[model samples]
Target: CKCPLGFEGINCTDNIDDCSNHTCQFGVCIDKINGYTCKCHSGFIGKFCEITSQLKSSLLQNNRTEILSKTCTPEICSNNGICYEDSLNRVQCRCSPGFIGDRCLMLKSVHANRNDSYMKLSKPKIFPHLNITMIFSTIQNNGILIYFGHMGHIVAELFMGRIRVSHDIGNSPGSVVFSYHTVNDGKIHELQLISIGQNFSLIVDRSYTRFINNRGIRTYMNTSEMDG
Candidate 1:
């Protein structure tokens, strides 16, 4: 059957969606006759929006010009952001919550008062490798900050002015409370959490860095299978 530039079906009546398989790596995809085009976000370029804007200032420590040979990679996405290739095979970043930017290096602040609101994902997620960073403040001395996982879960909370983390890799869940600085001073504090395999470490910046250079906390169940 004879079909137009962007028409399909046995009788050439169905309009073909060229954009279905052509997604912009950093911006929007617009469909055209038998093809698609990309509208890259600020600081990106390429036929499929795969290049980073940093290329414009390619300079060495001595201010020598550098050259480009490839597009962005998994390392390009910072702040626990994940890099991916889009439908058109261009580079893109999957940022964590409270983050934005082409490389996910910027923080998007969220202000919450007493019982303001909470967010629940409509789907479950997996985290073979994870890093989460945030800044928060509270007048209360105890509460949960973040909770994630399914069969194996992890929870970070404020335990009596200290940072506590509860985790379960595959077995029973266990917890560890940071014994350093206090954080419930009604002022903002920075929190960074990282997990490699079954090991985990954290840093709570409240006039001090806690738990980062120290030991990691492992999660396990007690004789009564209770959260510690």
Candidate 2:
């Protein structure tokens, strides 16, 4: 009795069904000329192979019953972020810019720049002031609008460098709105100043800005903050 392509016992009579025996949950058992090979499934490895391919995969899935049965260990993701196992049984880190550690507990570089210069804001300094210059161009028929929100007071200035006339919102803070009109093509410049005592501001530069104000409408007011 000879074993099948990937099974091995005494007389090859034993069917080394990787799936049935839970031997290769993450891999396929490939039958070789002499003996059967346990092609461990993704996230699993070893000969007869019971080792896990991913390190952190077991850690993140600690509460699951399936993981407890396996010989693999936890602590997969190196960074502090969540550990995600790929289709190849490999582990990956969904890490943030400045931090780079196995469990994401280590800091790689405190001031690492990830993207364009226009999007970086560091420390808390108001005197020097941060300048952001953006170039926007659109066709005549295209409707473009800019929208922004802030927790504190701030002044925003809009300029239409092109021949087309651009709408402008005043120095008022909280929420600012602006639209582009006239001429087929144009250029606009926007300057935003973060006022004193203000903590954070969210600015969105886009072609269409939608404003939903329920000033005239009346709705029930709760004694406490609304939690949905």
Candidate 3:
């Protein structure tokens, strides 16, 4: 008995699958006569076709090795955003939907500006209470991490650095400031605020601050606008 064209056993019982264990990386491995062929995938080429064509093209354009320098690391852009360097060599981040900020770390907002930013939400069926939670990291000593507006009025605001909750109740403004560890050390910090009935509390890390609303005996009596 003789072995067939694509077989190599004593009775042509074995079929040669050259793609076994062959690392194609970015291509497919095709079996051939006496050997195998690498079918390079799109944007890749070489003998094994494992090299990225984009990198190869850059190398051929000029001898300057700087063309191959990658400014954006794999982890540089958060939330599946593309990281690329502009013509001025500044790193830029393109964030996806529901994400913002320089590194795509911020949740998308309705209105944004250097002075102030806000997110407007549809009025809920009930407005008896408000609760908020946020996680952020910044070195700025002041900023509004969260704000809630109801009936064309500023109802609540959570400030940065020192956790503060300012609110308006029946044409009177009240605030509760909590002394806690600041998040200006380039680390993420969690802040939570809950308002129910005639009471509210602010929590930063392990520190807690609570305020009670006294209808007859007012602890704080001031009418002012809260800053964000």
Candidate 4:
């Protein structure tokens, strides 16, 4: 019989701990589960702590002036988040998806998923991919969905009802990918984009449009976006 996550045995009496295996490849193993999780000895993501993603050391954000005061109040954290001590001993608020920044206060305009991990684009450190999702509907057919620029730019836009995502790594020429479907329909639609390196994918309502370039994304996608 198939056993539930973390459980195995004829009667499911045994608990399977892959923490020592390739599961926690980049992070430490923590049997505990917590929200605002990304806590340590490493991380435990999602409801069951089933997903073992990369989580490393992080400092307490300066936004929490009161954190060092040795106090944790509900007011400091939003969305019913819980205050927990991260690996660095810095106090952080752990909660549901879509929120980033100190205290998980910045609710992204785009709807996001739980798999969307906490990120600080301000840092030079890059990751394999950046994921974000949102459900929206509008009569307008053109606008920028998201934009990140510094030496160059990574952007996604709704052009004539179709989704287009483009990026340039370092000082190189940019590459782009477009979605297979248009979402100008009256009904609310979901859109998600993952752009990195020389490849990217545009996902609309579960349908996907992907692209690959000789560039082969190598470093962390750059951080920060333009207002207009």
Candidate 5:
């Protein structure tokens, strides 16, 4: 009977213990069905002999799986989040709302909307790599609101009539940017509202503003204006 990959002995009964000698001298002695085969340790190869090869491929792969399995998964950040390994081998947490911390052991601030007048302008952007979602909401009066719970960084914009507001929360300009042009003439109040970040824009007449951008622009004109 042949033992598995790591074990070795007579009739595959003995384990080729590598630790006894502090390390395998030449190569690992893998016990087989009736005997054992010497898998030369790193840097050495050949049959019942000693030959060094610069291309030591087999030795490099040894114990790689076991070492990887021993790495501990990190548990950081708050709110029922998960731990993941970054490129630097550092563990980071993907936290939930109302929770935040280095090890996910602390509570974070909570902001909930109770007003029924407000509505979410657009759906959240999904990032599969970071396992996060970013959502943007808007109200008739409050402008745009960003929610980044598990997501890393988010960029959004909001527009109202001739005013445009945009922001990149994770980048330099953390606050909103405002741009607009005023139209004093009340006869044909043509205001163009452009929100580049949100991919939306709008044009408003005397009664209401028309929205445009990614969601498409619509003009909100009065009944009289529509009739004309």
Candidate 6:
């Protein structure tokens, strides 16, 4: 006798399969002579494996079913980052406070000793317009504040209880001095230097002094560096 669709027994009398259309849904199918069985995959259970486990189904539905494969692996994100896609759909490496950068690779600050300590900074491009201001309290009457350009062509120095800024363009050299009697009295003082249209001005405690050099070559604060 010829066997019917799901049955392959000699007499075709055994109902071995409980699967649908001889196939399993979210499960595996097995033959039982004249029938088949549905061996449900994880998180599913039923005669045909059609029912979802209550707790696990809710978890998957709430967490987006499609992105289950896009999760961050434990080895992927550094610095203990709980990886998740941001609203912009871009991956973000969330960093804690006092930490920054995409991978949290930078620290905000480092403790340093009082003497022989320095911090490094990236070099920046030069701009034409410039204004410099300094507020300081010093007991020394002779020291350098700011020096720049080749051979210290431009400088702001403290000499003999006075703040002096000297600039030289071609052969025309000029200096502006702000002599405050109490400058070295260990009191805070403000000094500002402003450059515009080949001219510079010095202001000490709101007292303004304008210096006009020989009107020939236009000059701006050109410097390879500036340091104390």
Misplaced by over 4 Å in model 3 are 1-117, 124-126, 149-160, 206-209, 214-228
RMSD of each: 13.9, 21.0, 21.4, 19.7, 25.9, 28.6
184, model 5: CA deviation in Å?
40
> Model 4, range 1-116, lDDT digits (tens) per residue?
87776777899877665433323222345553221222223343433333322211123333335434345676766555678777777677785454455655444433222233
Arrange candidates, best lDDT first. Answer: 1, 3, 4, 6, 5, 2
Q: Scored by CA lDDT, what does every candidate get?
A: 0.62, 0.36, 0.56, 0.55, 0.38, 0.55
**Candidate 3 lDDT tens digits, 1-228:** 687666778777777776554545456778765567778878767767645465465556756444333588877666687888999897788876446656664444222322543455554322446556666666677766665544222232334656556644443545445545556665756666665544566666646565645233332222233323
lDDT value for candidate 1?
A: 0.62
- The best candidate by TM-score is 1
Segments of candidate 6 deviating more than 4 angstroms = 1-127, 169-176, 180-182, 223-228
User: In angstroms, how far off is 10's CA in candidate 6?
Assistant: 95
TM-score of 2: 0.20
- In model 6, where is the ten-residue run with the lowest total lDDT? 109-118
Better of 5 and 6 by TM-score: 6
> Which stretches of candidate 4 lie above 4 Å from their native place?
1-125, 214-228
Look at candidate 4 and give me any clashing residue pairs. Answer: 36-94, 36-95, 111-133, 111-134, 126-220, 197-217, 198-217
lDDT tens readout by residue for model 2, 1-228? 655576577876665544332333335656445445666555545564444444345456564344322122345443345566657665555654334534453333322122221222333233313333333343434332222222121233333522211111222323443334333344432322222222223233433333322122222112123222
TM-score of 1: 0.42
> Any runs in candidate 1 off by more than 4 Å, and if so which?
1-107, 113-116, 121-127, 206-228
Residues 160-220, model 6: lDDT tens digits? 8788778653335544445444466677677777656456667776765656442455454
Question: What lDDT does candidate 4 reach at residue 120?
Answer: 34
**Model 6 collision count:** 4
In candidate 6 the C-alpha lDDT for residue 19 amounts to 36
State which candidate has the highest lDDT. 1
Q: TM-score for all predictions?
A: 0.42, 0.20, 0.39, 0.41, 0.23, 0.39
Candidate 4 displacement at residue 8 in angstroms = 69
Candidate 5, residue 119: CA error in Å? 15
